[model samples]
Target: MPTLEDEIRRLMADETARLHAAPDLAERVMRSSRSKRRRVRVAALATSVAVIAAAPIGYLTVGSVAMTGQEPTISVVPEPPPIDDTPPVPTEPPNLGDLGDGREFGHVRVGYLPERLQWSQRSVDNGDRYSITYNYKGDDKGSYRVQIHMYEEEAVQEVDDQIQAYRGEEDGEGVTVGARSGYLVVQNVGEDGMKGTPTLFLRMGDRQWAEIMFSPVYAEEFSSAEAVDAELKRIGEGLTSTM
Candidate 1:
């Protein structure tokens, strides 16, 4: 029958066949490895893209302020000033010359006067003008003369010589006196020339102007002419314009 050599060879052949793997086993392992590699590469690429996209925002927020203890400053705004609304016009007093003493006159004064009148005399011409007069106290026969001229110029459209008999009229009533616009002239100058007076003109700004005369014939003080035109309009409304 078969010997020892043939028996040993057969046993070896059976063991080898039992230990062999299927042909596709190695190929499957390789494919799996390649898929894993591809997945890893894709993940890494996505991570890189995300980091790149966030770089600008991170730098602006953190790097800008953190690096220099002082963040970027953006401030700007300013625009205002323009409102006038209009409504303001009445100003004209400044020509402060002659000061005053008995009845004041730097702008004006003599608020009411009458007591046999007597502030005597004064004249001052060049220092812008003045006149003052007043007389009647203890009369002697000169009756009255309450003059007062003060003028830094302005109300005179000529008509001087005792108001030239109220020149062609028109500038005679409309009195507000003491602060502006006044007129009430009356002139006659008859006792052989300077005898009937009665002036009163006003306007004290825009270069000043005032004249408040009243001469009832050398001092015959009121009697008629409507009581000397009601005491020359009550001394031209009690004058008083220190401007």
Candidate 2:
């Protein structure tokens, strides 16, 4: 008893198999709804009422493209640490190591220096084959640079074995500068702890010797290496070098 043109060709083959059509589109729409050609049965009942109103928006757009195949998880928040600005290391060392009756090279009389340093008036005498350099005020690479050399005998253990043949071990000591038994070597260290390069070898006589060089800026104010070996063992015990 189905014949409103067979219930409109079985409701256009169940709305063309609920919109997954195109497999021969429901047998070419049931052969154009068995047309005797009333404009092919009113264009197959207006293409089965537009495929039953687009089968619920084609099943909610294929269930919204299978629930967006997973992609929203973003929560990242990590980046905040860097501001040490560095400026604190003076636990005492600015009495200005007396440079008063000091400052002589050829006849050798090095009083002392280290703070506003001076004498980069630069000097070099051909007598004891002397050398003298001291800088800082206007910065001649100053953080402390005092190069005073006057050797004839030389050997506070050959200046600690020439800084142990250029640093094989590391630290060396024997201080008391002006009163003289100096030999604080340790050059170029910084493996990771950072601080080395003291070099002070003053002897003033087994034939007279002096070589004080300090410019690793005492690791910015002695923290270790035995507080830069007790601050270069009170340098030069007050050297009065005429030797």
Candidate 3:
């Protein structure tokens, strides 16, 4: 048989082992629940932080569109102006008689073709023996006139070149009439029809020359070229022999 003290000691040992085996079970469960709640709170806090970070970017994009209302502005510029054109006219027809007497030693003659046209003769004192003959075919549609000058060979050649350059070669002839040797330049002049006009230039010396010009507006109006030739021949006959 066991003693009473021994049995009491054995029972106390069993109770102590059971208490140790099931120690603070509720407190442990409560602690695990509290830890899970803290972890959830921390996860929520992290999500809230992420939302805060993304909010500013979204707000800025929406704010930019709202502030502008539409699109941005642009500018443009304009242009400038343009320029002019036209030609000049003559004042008066040269006077034949005055030019002859003033330039030539007053050795001049004026005549009409077919005795119908009015003509004049003048001279210019160019320090040389020279004369200018002016034939006026009246101021009308069927009337034309020309001025002729007689001067030195060089002077005559220069004038001839100028005339040739102005009106290209048509017809001409060389002649040694009286004491002068020169050429007669002829052309058909008129916008409507051909009016045969002849311009004569005689080079008498190195410094002396003579010119004869005939311009007919309606050359058909004249009796004949022979008549014009006769007039020119008469004028040639009238040249001064002493120059």
Candidate 4:
């Protein structure tokens, strides 16, 4: 039979072995506490990240509306206005017919002048011929001038070769003055390279010939060579005989 001390010792050894081999309660408690603290820290970090990410979105939304009371909208570019392309109207010409009656240069009677031209002077050149001059204040400086000359002979003795001298052509292109046949000649007057002053040479009946000259420096009087030519044609067509 075992002694009582031996039984007591066996009981104590069994309890010690169970305590050593059993699950460690204190270590389990420490592990659970550490897990809980880790969960808390992870939750706080997630909350902080969410707040930081939302802050930019909130600031941008508020900033856009802070300046004006409205949110941002797309800008539109406006179209340009239309241009005006209408031409200006021309001015009306003044009436000047019947201005030549009672005025005589040699056997030629003054018949007409353009609206602005005024009679200036008259002189008898030689004994049987004469000239009548007209003046116009058409521009600021130089004046528009016209001169009508007549000769007793049927030929333009002084200017007979004028056409040949300038154009190297003879019996210049035929033109009509009133009811009579005439010739046209253009000659440069001044140093300016512009088209020359236009002159009309015509035979009047069998007794005389006439020359009419139109100076070209009338700045405002004529806009183009065609306009001046038209006026000259009108003047030539209006000439009449005094005799």
**Which runs of model 3 end up more than 4 angstroms from their true locations?**
1-146, 152-154, 160-170, 188-192, 218-221, 241-243
Question: For residues 5-122, could you state the per-residue lDDT of candidate 3 as single tens digits?
Answer: 4565566566657777444454455578668866666665555455546653322112111222233222222233334454556544433343423223344333323343343433
Ranking of all candidate structures by their lDDT, best first: 4, 1, 2, 3
Give a tens-digit lDDT track for model 1, residues 10-33. Answer: 554565467675544444555786
How well does each candidate superpose onto the true structure, as a TM-score?
0.23, 0.24, 0.39, 0.47
Go through the candidates in order and give each one's C-alpha lDDT: 0.58, 0.57, 0.51, 0.60
Per-residue CA lDDT of candidate 4, range 1-243, in tens? 887655655665676577884444444555686688666666655554555466532222212212222333222234456688888889533322333532565567766787777765334355556666677554422243877777666345655565456456452466776678776766664566675767777766666667777876542368876676667767776777665
Q: Which ten residues in a row have the lowest lDDT in candidate 4?
A: 58-67
**By TM-score, how accurate is candidate 4?**
0.47
Backbone N/Cα/C clashes per model: 9, 10, 24, 0
Return whichever of 3 and 4 wins on TM-score: 4
Quickly count the clashes in candidate 2.
10
Q: List the residue pairs that clash in candidate 4.
A: none
